[model samples]
Target: MEKHPRVKLHFTLTRSSWLNVIERWTGQPERNTLYHGCFTSVKDLRETIKIFIDSHNTHSAKPFRWSQAADAILASVDPARTSMILNS
Candidate 1:
């Protein structure tokens, strides 16, 4: 890590690849959307990626929303740690 002092390193927790939520979200598009489409040119590929990412961001950008279950989960905290937040 010292060899690349300027670059940031982020280590995912061992034994839980699925715990990486971004990986889970990316995997959904890779399997169901990206891999199925054939792009004719770089411009086409870029446009496709932009459209998909924009669609994802529209729904996934917020932390708490009335219609999304993921937002509800994000809004929740462990009950055991709730008291710590109050005390702090």
Candidate 2:
């Protein structure tokens, strides 16, 4: 770190990956079907959830795209830079 002072570090808590997946997957169904929904019995709740999932699955889900274009990042660096962004 001392040798390359311009670099920065970010830290993530252990097991954070599951938390991200759980949040993304549950948000839509929870918002539309489960949140504040009234069901008369256990069977009613399960049936509603099953229907919601089946309906949701009919629509195609898009793949996550990772476009790691570095142009914008490099542009943000100061013009008075000395060292190359990547060391040889």
Candidate 3:
């Protein structure tokens, strides 16, 4: 890392929050199009996924909105709130 002075590194303590958002978004197609559907071969599955991605990108893709304030997000995951959720 020291060899590349211009490069910066970012580390996450847990799964990337952005990755969770992406997974949630991609999961829709998995549930709606892939699940319980039969594919004759690897190519078929690839094509299906491609078609779904293309359709989504062309029709339903939208810029993600971050409406929640950071404080609100922090509050929701505070230790006290986590304990309450776990105990319940």
Candidate 4:
């Protein structure tokens, strides 16, 4: 890590809900394009991704909806522990 002074590292907990959400979102493209598909070159892969993104944006793009209410989300956290972590 010292070799790249400009790089920053972020650590997330195992089985984090936020990480799961992102994985689930990206899994669509991986399953649809990359899983059983093969590309001749990097350019081909780029074009495939571009087409997938464009089609997804045009037809199925929608804002993410939070399943939990703000208060419920906050309630799941321990306020004292959160404060301690923040202070650390």
TM-score of each: 0.45, 0.45, 0.51, 0.51
What is the model-wide C-alpha lDDT for candidate 2? 0.69
Quick one: ranking by lDDT, best first?
A: 3, 4, 2, 1
Off by over 4 Å in 3: 1-15, 63-88
Note the residue pairs that clash in candidate 3.
none
| Model 2: lDDT of residue 30 | 82
Give each model's whole-structure lDDT: 0.68, 0.69, 0.80, 0.78
TM-score of 2: 0.45
lDDT of 1 by residue, 1-88 (tens): 6467596544433455446766887787778677989989999988888888898789776663456577665566344346555534
lDDT of 3 by residue, 8-74 (tens): 5553345468787788988987898999889999999999999999998899899778689989879
Ranking by TM-score: 4, 3, 1, 2
Q: Which candidate has the highest lDDT of all?
A: 3
Pairs in clash, predicted candidate 1:
none
Error of 3 at 20 (Å): 2.0
Prediction 1 global C-alpha lDDT: 0.68
Give the per-residue lDDT of model 2 (tens digit) for 1-88. 8467787654334446758876887787788889989989999999988888788777745566645557864564434233333422
